[model samples]
Target: MKIAVLDPDRTQADLITQVLTQAGHVVQTFGSGKDLLGQLRKDACDMLVMDWHVHDVAPVDILRRAKEKLPEGTPMMFITNSSGEDDIVAGKDAGADDYLIKPLRRGELLVRTQAMLRRAYPSQNGAEQLTFGQYTFETRPGRLLMSGVPIEVTHKEFYLALLFFRNIGRPLSRAYIHESVWIRETVVPSRTMDTHVSRVRNKLQLRPENGFRLVPVYSYGYRLEKLGG
Candidate 1:
């Protein structure tokens, strides 16, 4: 998952970024409210880790406006030095899902983040294998099977296919897919994902005839949609 951290303090921001990165997440850090809001205007992340203070911007105002820009119900956590009861209530009212006071506990932050992500994405039920119609994805060995027949696929292909199935009806942005699957690949080739998506489509027979359609979203990414019964 990708997370955007908004904190002006360099040390604190680096610590938060390192913690999230070590926990298997891509972290983007912003030093000011303007920068964070600008990023939000372009694209949103899976989660937001924000500080309550950012120059002249009021926490409540920024929180309320940022929430309006992001996708509905996206989880956001406030990490600040303020521990006042009134501030906590105001933060929640503005749109924070969770709040942590300054001097954060690394373990506590990770645990809260996991809980928030789990609640937001219930499709991840920790199953070793997942089935949709005749298609089966076994995560243990990262294999795919079709009606008891094994399918030969590269590592990327298996995980890419699994992502679509896990998010059956959702529109997955190209950046999101790349960051999730090719986590180590910093520079992405324009055609790299397209080629793999093509391979997955052809190999899996992801067509209307096969009960699914892998269609491209103009200027966005792709969506895996289920076909008719």
Candidate 2:
């Protein structure tokens, strides 16, 4: 999982990054709320750990903005010295998933982070497999199979396909797809997404005969719909 940490204190940020990294997560640290917000504009992370008091922007403000940009239900944690009831209320109201009072304990941080990830991305938490009709995904081995036959896919393609399978029958906006799969905030060209969609369609053989179809949603993005009844 990719995590973004926003802290004005370099030492605390580094400590958080180190702990998360050791646990096999990709961590990016930002020195100010402004920088973190900027990064979020072009990229998305799996989780966000932010200081309650940031140099340029308030933590609640950042949370609000992040919620607007990130996918629905993206987990956010607040690590700060403020422990007042009002502060806690404000954090939750602004959409923070968890709050950790600072002088953060390494063990507590790890545990809370793992818990949040498990809730937000269950597949990452140890679900070994996911199936959609004839297709099956083996998370542990990072393999995809159709009718018990192996299918070759690139790293990006695999993630993209997994996203579609997870949200089968739902229309996913292009922005959502880009952020979820690429984890970048930069504007992705339409053709880039289109090309990948085309590849996934061909590779996965999503068609009526296969009981599925990966179809474009006009101007929005794409949808993976199950065919037949």
Candidate 1 lDDT over residue span 1-229, tens digit each: 8899999999989878866875568999999888888889999888888887778678788788788898887899997674567778888999899998767655457657867987876676364677898899886577899888999999989988987887788898887777667755667797999999999999999989889999998888999999885
TM-score of each: 0.54, 0.55
Worst 10 residues of 2 by lDDT: 179-188
RMSD values for the candidates in order, in angstroms, are: 13.0, 14.6
Task: At residue 111, give the lDDT of candidate 2.
Answer: 64
* Alpha carbon lDDT of each predicted model: 0.83, 0.84
Stretches of model 2 off by over 4 angstroms after superposition: 127-229
Prediction 2 global C-alpha lDDT: 0.84
lDDT (Cα, 0-100) at 160 in candidate 1:
84
